[model samples]
Target: MTKREIDEVSGVETTGHEWDGIKELNNPMPRWWLWTFYATIVWAAGYTIAYPAWPMISSATSGVLGFSSRGDLKAEMTAAETAKQDYAQTIAAKSADEILADDQLREFATAAGAAAFKVNCIQCHGSGAEGSAGFPNLNDDDWLWGGSADAIYHTIAHGIRFEGDPDTRYSEMPAFGDMLSKDEIRQVSSYVASLTGNSTDEQAAAAGKQVFADNCASCHGDDGTGDREFGAPNLADAIWLYGSSEAEIARQVRTPRHGMMPAWSARLGDTTVKELAVYVHSLGGGE
Candidate 1:
């Protein structure tokens, strides 16, 4: 039957004689939709020929234009490298001290170093370099190693307190657990606290003074002031490595705490390391 007549007719076709008032229409596919489907097939064939659309055993087919995602990425990387070359040249030519002197260059280095710190150093040093219980605060002037440009650079290039590193800085604070009794530890901690003028029990502080004279006088001096050459922290100052809590101090005296700050020179490059040191030094604690 003609298309229009087929649409108007009721019960045009049925599988068998219907028992209820339900029947199926004798439908044909829409001609417009059929034409569009044919068009899609043709378009797909054209697209397959012009683009890398087909898969092979080992790789995909190359398109007529020879376009590649890898090639695009390579071009982008090359452009980025070219842009960075000028900055890199400036960094290489300038000395760390010179960079520190130039406000503009120092600013650039600061920005660059900040980015590097976020990725590499911030985890241990903290975002502000204030440090945690074990870690040393970069914002403070107290450096176990040295804070000079060369010293900072060297430290970054070669890590300290790390295993398997031949040149790694090595020093172990002897654990007093086996040597000193609990009362002695508490006394020593109180003495250490008194040196810094922190609140402490007078009796405990007095007892700790004798322990300090016997055990800690050589490195820490008679007054509990530190010897920088030995990397001993000054007990006279308010700065505490682990913390100032009485409990924290007592624990340290009993067990000792050794924290390691990673070196960044090799990983961040000399210029970046210098910039980071300068930035850290300027953070209200540079001596």
Candidate 2:
């Protein structure tokens, strides 16, 4: 049997380990440190039994506490749905004017309308409602069929030139290519462009003024002011749906492009359509 060695310097025992001429001291860990290490082991064991810890083949082992993250999420979602239902019921029972009159209802309707617009309208009207070449910007006060709340509501509910809805707003600009010569078309195009100061040829525009009076003044008023009854847009305004350039104007003169919007009454129902109208009106554009 190998006898344990004791250090000669302080009379402490050696650990029977040696590297070259050096010996390791048999020092015991402090009581506090030992207790802490033991406590950690006990905590870890208790935690494993109280919470989910083990991995199984198909699923994890549920701990004794029986808590589930999915259940908590479902409870939260149910509460939100219940709250939303209350507001939805109230909106369904009220008219557009009545809802607007009540501050609480109007706020709820505006938020709901904004949400619907993001889902259904961002494709055409743009994310910020700025609009593109063919689409009309919802952010602006310039409106073709009038910007009144009732008018906007009607347009949204029934749509514009949509074949699916019989009550859809309808207007047709006759293609002048069928009746007028190419030069005449350019002349008329310049006249229309000149209304908004977008014309390139002054002489042509002067000559086209007569052409507009003879051919186009019926729908678009004599001074180029649009009639809302005819769904005609104001040619005098700089807000051109297609474009403000002479070439674009000439193209439109030759073959007028009609814009269309689908009726939402059937698809979205009355409540949502009213909400959408309120939201669009509150964008600082509705009259």
* Clash pairs, model 1 backbone: 156-263, 156-264, 156-265, 157-265, 157-266
The prediction achieving the highest lDDT against the true structure is: 2
lDDT of each: 0.74, 0.89
Model 2: per-residue Cα lDDT over 1-287, one tens digit each? 98878899978899988899899999889999999999999999998888778989987868899877778899999999998888888888877767788898889899999999999999999988888989999988898888866688889999999999989999999998898888888888899999988888999999899889988999999998889999988999888899888899889888999988999999998889989988988898888
Runs in model 2 deviating more than 4 A are: 1-68
lDDT of 1: 0.74
TM-score of candidate 2 on Cα atoms, chains taken together: 0.76
Counted clashes in each candidate structure: 5, 0
List, residue by residue over 1-287, the lDDT tens digit for candidate 1.
53332223564554333447555565567999999999999999988888788999999988888888888999999998886666657866876666677787777767777777788877887998888777777787676667765556556656767664566665667888899988888888888887767746999989888998998888878987777667677778878878886678888877887866565655666667776765665666654
Report the lDDT of model 1 for residue 224. Answer: 75
